[model samples]
Target: MNILIVYAHPEPNSLNGFLKDLAVETLSAAGHEVIVSDLYEKNFKAVADRNDFTELNNPEKLNYIQEQYHASKNRTFTSDILEEQDHLLWADIAIFQFPIWWTESPAILKGWFDRVLAYNFAYGPGHYDQGNLRGKKAMLSITHGASSLANYGAYGLKGDLDERLFNIQHEKLFFCGMDVIEPFIFHSSTKEDAKEGLFNDYRKKLLNISNEPVIPFHPLSHYEKGQLKDQYKTSIQQELEMS
Candidate 1:
């Protein structure tokens, strides 16, 4: 399977980088075509701008945007936006690796999503109503500075790890049509030295996601239909009761 690993750690010497490398090697060894988009290394621009929004009504401008779009799809180097779009199209699975900061992804990574996953490409009108990214799979591989248990929505803590990624995982990935796979999170990434075994175990887990329990797939239309599926309906109700 073709795999695109989008890594978003700033420091090259960080454990996040090491984990990324390990993942690359493992995936490559498994004979899966692996491409790493090292956002920092590539000096990838994360912000979107006016040039990105093509006006379809203006004939001259619409022609220009059409040219740009074709050039992008044809790989004539039309724009970075097209280039990233191409990568997503070529891959079957996409893995995002990053560090948790302020209960979210680092700025650059978030920016990557903001800029790259654009309208009509990732979602919205003229795109696949559901997961224009359909037939693809997505997973998150994140590291956090806090203790693992504390990150849980339960344990008198924040919320479940999955809850934290609801937007990016379900809303974003699923809306775009990618099958949302379970995430592999490592808590206390800052305390790696004291948790060598945990790191190894995490690595082992990362190497085995094909059979792992995936994050529950929640369709955006579910709510429109008035409620979540049976499993999630029960789980959410239970969560509310516990709270």
Candidate 2:
């Protein structure tokens, strides 16, 4: 499978960098075509603005979303954005390798999503499960500075790690119709001894990408008029109903 690794760490010697390298090496050794987008090295612009388009839909009004949609229709995205989008289109799987900052990906990576995943292409009407990226898969390879226990259940300082990543896994990747794989998190990433184990686990995950269970997401069929079917209300919603 073709794999695109969108790497966002600034330091090449960082743990996130090692994993990114390992992914490219391991996937390539397995005969999969691997492309790495080193955002920092490339000096990728993290801001989405008028510079993203060669021509604007409304030169007077700077509505980014409408401009993106119009540019997509006209094939007027800037070269950098078009190139990244093309890579996304070519890949069967996309891996995001980044260190969590303020409980989210770095601004550059977020901006990459804003610019590269054009409105008409990555999403629009009949989106989510019906999005343009339907058959592709996405995985998050994240490194967290906090310990695993600290990011765990009720007593932990931070809530569930999954909850922290919901915006990226659910809102972004899943919104684009990519089958989301459970994120591989390396907690307490500063520890040196964990490197070998982390590398091994990551290698296994990469090699078994086809077998990895996808995170369950409500399909388009489960929604009627933009709301989930009554039978599909999550447990939280059910609890609220009881209250």
Candidate 3:
């Protein structure tokens, strides 16, 4: 499988970096092609602006969505954005590896999504199940500075991790038609004592990731006027309850 690892950690020796490297090594050893986009190393631009487009469709007004749609159609996106978009299109599985900051991905990674998931490419009318990334997969490989048992959802101090990631997994990846693989989250990642064991488990997880569980995101058809159909409601509720 073709895998693209979009990594965002400032330090090369950090935990996120180690896991990113491990993923590349493990997947490549397993005969899967892998590519890593070390955002910080690349010095990636973290904010979207008019410069995103090579030539302006309307220079006066900076309507990002409008420009993205036109730029995607005209192939007028700047080189950096275009390059990442190409990688995104080429990948069968896209893994995002980063250390959680303020309950979210670092600014650079978010910028990647902002500029790379161009309109008319990643999302538009007839998106969701029919979106451009319909057959692709997305997985979050994240590290957080909190204890798994204490901060892990299901009535934990931080509520639910699943809920925290709903916008990303559901609104972003799923909305773009990518089936999200269950996230691989490491809690208290700064604990040096747990690093070796966690690394071992992470390597094993990467090797066996294809068999891991995928979150149940009902298809667009399962909704009626933007809500779950009556017949699907019970099952959806049951799944949420079980989670």
Best by TM-score: 3
Residue range 172-233, candidate 2, lDDT tens digits: 99898899988888875446786788779989998898789888878878889989889778
Q: Estimate each model's TM-score.
A: 0.78, 0.92, 0.92
- Per-residue CA lDDT of model 3 for 1-243, tens digit only, reads 999999999999977887898999999999999989889999999999999999988998889999999998999999999999999999999999998788888999999989998789898865788888998999999988875656766988987878878868888888898988989888754477876888898888889877767788888999888898887876654877878
Per-prediction backbone clash count: 7, 0, 0
RMSD of 3: 2.5
Clashing pairs in 2: none
Over 4 Å off, model 2: 189-192, 234-243
Residue 159 error, candidate 2, Å: 1.5
Per-residue error (Å), model 2, residue 221: 2.1
Ten contiguous residues with the weakest lDDT in model 1: 69-78
Ranked by lDDT, top first: 2, 3, 1
Runs in model 3 deviating more than 4 A are: 189-194, 235-243
